[model samples]
Target chain A: MSRNIRILGTGKYLPSKIVTSEELDRKLGLKEGWAAKKSGVKIRHVVDGEVNSDMAVKAIEQALKNANMTKEDLHCIISTSASFDQPLPCQASLIKEKMVFKNHPIPAFDIDSTCLGFVVGLDTISYLVEAERYKNVVIVSSEISSLAINPNQHESYTLFGDGACAVIISKSSKEETSSIKTSLIETYPEGVHMTEVRGGGSILHSRHYSEKNKTEYLFDMDGRAIFRLSSRLINGFMERLFKDSGLTIQDIDMVIPHQASAMAMKLMRKKLDVPEEKFMSIIENHGNVISASIPMALHEAIVQNRIKRGDKVLLLGTSAGLSLGGLVFEY
Target chain B: MSRNIRILGTGKYLPSKIVTSEELDRKLGLKEGWAAKKSGVKIRHVVDGEVNSDMAVKAIEQALKNANMTKEDLHCIISTSASFDQPLPCQASLIKEKMVFKNHPIPAFDIDSTCLGFVVGLDTISYLVEAERYKNVVIVSSEISSLAINPNQHESYTLFGDGACAVIISKSSKEETSSIKTSLIETYPEGVHMTEVRGGGSILHSRHYSEKNKTEYLFDMDGRAIFRLSSRLINGFMERLFKDSGLTIQDIDMVIPHQASAMAMKLMRKKLDVPEEKFMSIIENHGNVISASIPMALHEAIVQNRIKRGDKVLLLGTSAGLSLGGLVFEY
Candidate 1:
């Protein structure tokens, strides 16, 4: 029989340097309150000297401590990132190196699906644990979005932040903990260009670096396009997701969603029929840390005691692939 | 009870332009036979204008045809790539977009573990299939190493190629079809930097590009270091893998190892005690295509009738994370 999977611990790390909407407005030469009015992000964390792996390691360390476990106890590591430190060895491998477990004979890899990367990682990990392939798995989302966006692009510059979140999932040692109910992940790649950085990989390269290719080398997106499409389709998406899972809006106690943008979050809250307090939104302070948004908000919610044992929680988000994903679980 | 996963069909695509050792030797101002002698690679495919997604889509189309199926039959898609077309929506998403699946609601993502990436994707697919999450899954690997590497770097320039491979895996329609037996994956991230491109991500950017960071922007590796470490540690690694699976060398009919380098391949063959014919190698003509090497060779091996039904084949490889992984299945 398959074993039950539970989220054992959650941890998040924000860079020390904080950049407020005022600072972003000044940098982008916008009027005061323009960024905040446009994106609903008041302040976001910006890294100084640290890289993606640095933030990832810190999140994992805290997650391990929260679980009352050590790095050696982890059977597998799955990292998700939109803003990677490098393309090769992967974020998980770098984290293992920094965690000082160079000889840890465990399976480690990275999953890239943009903002829904963490949800994708969670879905993958749930299956691994259910198969009894692993006992304890660490799912990490680290983003250095501040370094990825072009400072001149006011839209993305004011929306993205730098942060990391790590969550440990395992068989519940105590029977009281809740188990994962259902996870729904769907990708519509037709919207691939909706929000993207074309040069994030080999499509654009430094070898052919030129002044003309400057904007192409940074984060670019059709925010209005995504907003229009998501608003129209998300209602039906959520309806089917909940109906198929034998759940409804009333069954959910808290909704943790990817803090994509101010308008997107407000639209989702109204569509999902959740109260303001029930709808989690840490992005107003942390901004959008790509894949880390949902998990970081979930971690903060847990820390603030917004969720308790036996509560039903919902995690949902729309990602770069125009993907819409949701996970329903009891906490 | 868990279901059995089987490889239904495989396909590969090599770029039309072939760069022979002599051509590379002349380009690098080396002796005529320098590249062939140093890396044991005679010729490698070089792409002119094709992107990673283009190669991936072609490979997948061929694989689907070989499986006597079509794109709609696939329930999920997993892409393993070391060199990606872009970083945001993921290579899998890009492939989905290019494949004209404007609204195919399937789960798609990219797994990065360097050369072991395909193996990781296979492992994840196996669990998903066994759990009955999906009926048919496609794993595609596409690499544009020629474009990724620095032209001046002789070591990597001659040893890398541009290619793609796609395999369709699903539940066997026939009762007599072969099934997956066991899989083992291990990572030691201490060697993360041994094979990496420091500027491939946010660590360094084109916006801040400079002459001093030239080598960091392209693929670089300590080949000798990886060879020495892998050669020293593979014996114990294989021993544990085989012993845990309760299998001995005599049970295996073929070994499909990653074509990392001529030297690394030879060392792995000797260390594993596999016969010459049982160990497959296609790198002499194709060089290393990163994550696509194993699947591409497997496709060639099947076409050449190297193994038949009920035969045991072992897929094993060492990747950049100092990772050693293998899968044993009956084919």
Candidate 2:
């Protein structure tokens, strides 16, 4: 029998600070409705003094509660994030420590793939669980993109929020109720340079900083190019995913794309010919939470009764690495 | 029948610039033999203008040649590293562009767990291959640790080197003479703070350049604590590994430990009761290459005829994440 990795629980945490597009426009000297109409974003949540680990912990706590699981039940914890609290020990270690799971000594670490990180991590967990190497896995996607955004940089500052989401994947042999039925990950390296953070990291250290040289270490992006690429890749990936799984678009009850720009999501919907009701998006309120976008949206969708048990949900994401991935799950 | 993931090819790339411990001492005000006697590091490579992607491309090129495979043969490429060029798009995507493979798009991304990255990456690939999700996989572990080192910080400066290693894994069911037998990964979150880079990440980004900042965002380590933890974990893991594999120490031909420090290796060897001749240390020439250390040493061992075609080689590593992992492979 083929072992299936099922998501037993799902949870998300978004900071309470809400900044409206008008407020952002006034703060950054932009025209009214510019942020909303251009990106389909009305507001975004910004965390106060909340790091990636903090957000991840919140999400994980809620997820465990929902799953009725203790830390000891987890065999592995894989946390994915673009923003890290430290460069040496991964952010997951911090979460492991804070949660006081030290006694279990569960293997935990951070996985990164920009915005597609969570999907990749989820797939990795699925593989491990199916191989019987791990019984219970906790995959957390958390980001404090606001910390990397330069408030002075109008483009990125208005487009990123702070949030985290967690999914508890368990090994199961049942056919119909499995959480992750199938997953596909694909990368288009040619589009990597279109979006990125130019500074920071070992490539550009703080020691290289000079009083006169105020480098923009903040997130930098080519909005127009990303839009075009996102539309093409998102649609292409969805088509291939459905085909590979021997399913049709009509079989998918919900589509959760990365909560990046409102325009990109709309473009994807139009290109894929999927109805707006079939798509779930949280970008209007949360902006781009990077890896956390899809799962966070899933959490909201579940809460709002947009999805029900046995629903086939397509979780898709695309990011600066010019990377894209999707997972079809029966929830 | 269980499918096995076999290493079809292996390749490594060292920067052209080599710096002897004496040379590094002259530049950093350290004793000449301190690195060699204490850390078993005689010389280490340094990348000048080249970055992680450059080394990755070079290693992947050689790996392809050795495997007699083109980029199209690969279904997935997983890059593992601690020192990345940027925080977005992932280093794997950059390497994918260089290959320019014409076929179905291959999934690629980066995995980080400090020095244990390579072992964990291989384990992940093994699980994915066994699941029959991917047929051909390439795992690369590369680091530009020098980029993170503060030349003036004598402690971290003496311990790091830049290098890259790549291994191509493919699905094989043949009864091979030697192959990746088994592997185990463990993480001790309580010990994460024993060694770390205090700056450049989200935690210190705010106070990175502040005068009040005591930690310089450079690599900081509590060597004594790490020694204790390393010895305990490495010894304990090897015991369990050997028992699980039903192999004795005498059956193992060679033991390759992460090229961290000579003292740690010696202590571990003593605890494990392994003969000195059965162990190999490349730190004498490569220092601590972090994630790249084991593969680089394995490559050197293979070239030097220290390991035979069917030799049982044990690879182990531990790092700042307080993470440790091991793999048993047939040479």
Candidate 3:
């Protein structure tokens, strides 16, 4: 019999500073309720000095504690983050060093799939465990979206928050009691340009930077295009995921779409014909944490008693790579 | 029974411009044979206007052609590159958009494990195929190391290159014979800082750029430290890989270590007690293409008849992520 990889625990960490619509409106000269109504974000967490790795460490610690596992028990550590502290050592290496796992010698690295990174990491870990290459893996998705956000760019600034989420996945002998039974992934490259950080990579190195091009260094977004694509793709991906898993929407006790915008989630709910109660949304408190959004939502759902043992949960996410993915798990 | 993932084809592309040691010595006021003796590189391919994505496209196209499979046949595309065109909308997405795949909508994204990226990507594809999640997967590793090179720094500039390499992996079936079998991945985050690009990421964005700190933006290396780690780890990894595969080093037809430096490979060969004739080196022509080195070496071996169908091949690589991995395959 084939072994199954399961999510043993979930954890999330959000910045303490919460920026309300009124505060942002005052700072950005926007009308009250405008940001709230359009993005369905009354407030969003923003990191002060904390970096992506810092947030990831917090989430991983919580996840390990919840799983009753220690760093020594981990065979792999896969971190996914778009806003990295550095380009050379990889954010994963930094986390490994900071956590002092030098003697453990476990393989740790980072995966970049834009916003769908966490799901991709999760899927990759599941594959490894199923292949019997590893016994335990820790997947962390951390993003300080606020660092990339252009304060002057209202569209992006009001929509992003700083946060991270993580889950410990391990090989389980009790196949019937596992969380993640299967995962399906899909991507559409046509939507790649809908959202992006226009600078800071090899494409726009420091040599190209000038005072006149300050705006180009910050995150940019085609809000309308992303919203339209997200609404269409999320529904299509969820449907395909259900078909792939041989499970119907009715079988899912909860649906956690990436918390990009409240409008996008509502549209997905309507398309999937699932009630709002079945869908979990953390946008009001954390905004869109990119790759961490779904896991953050899942963590919240579990704490709120929205998910229980044997309950089927569906996770769907989409991002700048025009990437979309879904995973089904029974907790 | 477990499924086996095998390599279907391999292809590589090098930049058109080649910088000979004579020219480099004159430019840097270095003694003749200095670079050749230190890094074993006599000439290095340098990118002109071409970027990582461009080279990857060429390799991917050739790999598909070699496999007699259309882009539509691929279910996933994973590109590994240290030099990315942008921070968002990963380089992998660009390839998916440019490649006409008969509307199959294959999932594509980037994975960054530095020099070990290609091996990591191959391992990922193996797991995906083993889980029956994907039938046809393409792994591409391309790097334009010149973009990160500090031309004034002769210590590092003369020992790098620009190139891309790709491999098509598929699930082995009764109708199709296996070529390359399985891969092993190991990472040592403790060694991450042995080589790195100190600037241009989120930690020190363009906002911090200054002429006085120009060197900060270029790739830096602790050559001696990396040499020590590479030599030690490559041999250890190879031994474990052969043991896991139930094979002996004498059974391998070729060894393709990352073309970081010739001395590193020589030391590793000595440690493994492998014959010089069984190992391949491309640093003499292409320098260190970072993530692209291993595949570029493998491509050359295949072209030179050093590797053949059912011949066991070993790939070992180490990079800034302080990430190191090894894979054993029968091709």
Candidate 4:
């Protein structure tokens, strides 16, 4: 199906508290510059006690303000958070409640794909806008990775941040040049267990808590295995993505990748042959913000004028589901 | 902006164990028949260590068999669980992993709206199928509430079960009468705290498990408050739903509602003026299976020859987001 989407506005928010690598070194009892050397993060914004919805509402407000729109102008809110504020009512409902300004019973739900959620949300909601079911839609991705961090797992712990992002979009008209060129999302579920938080779910019931079994509750990962599996598939996957659109990697204006880890992004760019200048990264200060990574980077790209109207922006990411998602869209 | 969908088949799976009210009466130290009197559940299937994806794959297999199709025929799988197997990779990826026969890299994701998830999944995926982004889409809602049940909260605990339901759907051709007519979903975030599981997300931090804070890890609900809030809005919501379709109560052939609770279903039928036979009920035997409730009931209605081709079937439910969703589609 052919569909077009106009980026009305993009906005992002980070937690107020900043944690530097020096602070992490002191906290984790690591050597000076050791944390930065390993994670490639100098400083990261981490939430102290703020709820996910608090950061989320701020981002949504900025997006609406940027577009000169209001909550009343939205038809539905799609919350695409990897981690959540609460699990029961879904993230979107909590977000809507926090967004009290001019808030009505606008329909809300959640699309969860871990880190690659932003790309999927944009691709999924475009069909609704194109079908005319919604005139104006807001896609918000909020992640509180700081709370999810396992201080014991310093390897993955230092490489995380907390943030939220919102993108306001509408259907493009025939005269508009903005449109999604092509997209692909594929999951290799065999690698599902490589990186995950085992608690807070039915399989690893939270009620079955004990001091001996604490590791299951924290973030667990076989980082090398995940990278090995992802690397095997990405080359062919990227080829098919551009091939389907009758375009090449060099044809893209800019690349916005999931700020997964400093090393992963570097490896991905090298493997895909994307130039260092062409790849967008906020990992130096932001670390990996989970599902908010792509949109947060996109928002930064937009404000910096690195990507203007009619720019072909490539969004690519590998998520917890061992999912590889990529999209080339006109911004 | 028109879309049509044809249901090729529907299937359901129950756990291996059946927990009768008589058994619950003994287990909970209640008087004989007291459990059934309060919960209106004679028997309910509750999972006994079987994983969510295990039951989900079984349901999917049945659905595919009913349509004489294979997993390879599907372009995507949408897992719409109210509760999840895990909190990390999303429910759909885990399900895809379980359905290994003929499995390939089919795009998978989750649409979460608590108990109304099945309705939301069907409604949301329709836009994609109609746009020809996917030729065949399977929506599976697998929930295991038994493990999350708090033994102390008998009121909400007894009114739950575990099961999975899958529906195989495709785009309807021009001559087919099977089409989604009108759908409405609205969330009133004011009632967000009425029903929820406090643990398992970034907010309730699963790692903070302690003896003094055990209740936070289990399913918690303010049943009366939720009912009161839902009642205040449903009458108007139902009116708007049918009004949008230019139809009234009598136009519906079968009313398959979310098996939330026996009392809730009874109250809903009375408020909406739906006839006794038109309303389908499985709460007596199956109880409330969360997101699987509506589709499990729909699967029963189809196999029992209640909802037939050209029949106007209504799917309705109230969810944990304190959300209300309804849809009427021609079978």
Per-candidate TM-score against the hidden true structure: 0.97, 0.95, 0.95, 0.97
| Residue runs of model 1 more than 4 Å from their true location after superposition | A1-3, A173-177, B1-3
lDDT of 4 by residue, A1-331 (tens): 4478888998899988999999999999999998898888899998888888898899999999998997799999999998887778888988988887353787889988888888888888888888888889999998887776788889888998888999999999889989888888888888888888887787888777677877787777777888899899998889868875878888899999998788888998999899998999999988888899899999999998888898899999989888999988888
Chain A TM-score for each of the predictions: 0.96, 0.93, 0.94, 0.97
Clashing pairs in 1: none
| Ten contiguous residues minimizing lDDT sum, candidate 3 chain B | B176-185
> Across residues B204-225, which tens digit of lDDT does each residue of candidate 4 receive?
7777767788788788988888
DockQ of each: 0.67, 0.63, 0.63, 0.77
lDDT of 2 by residue, B271-308 (tens): 87888888888877787888888878877777688988
Docking class of 3: medium
DockQ ranking from best candidate downward: 4, 1, 3, 2
List ranges where model 2 is wrong by over 4 Å. A1-3, A151-153, A210-215, B1-3, B102-104, B151-155, B177-179, B210-215
The most accurate candidate by lDDT is 4
Q: Tell me the interface RMSD of every candidate, in Å.
A: 2.0, 2.5, 2.3, 1.3
Give the CAPRI class of candidate 2.
medium
The segments of candidate 3 whose C-alpha lies over 4 angstroms from its true place after superposition are: A1-3, B1-3, B175-183, B232-235
- Predicted candidate 1 versus true structure: per-residue lDDT over B265-299, tens digit per residue: 88778877888999999999999998999999889
Pairs of residues at least 3 apart in sequence or in different chains that clash in candidate 2: A310-A331, A321-B89, B199-B217
Residue-wise lDDT of candidate 3 within A62-121, one digit each (tens)?
998898888788888888877787777677887787777746767777787888888788
C-alpha displacement of B317 in model 2, angstroms?
Answer: 1.7
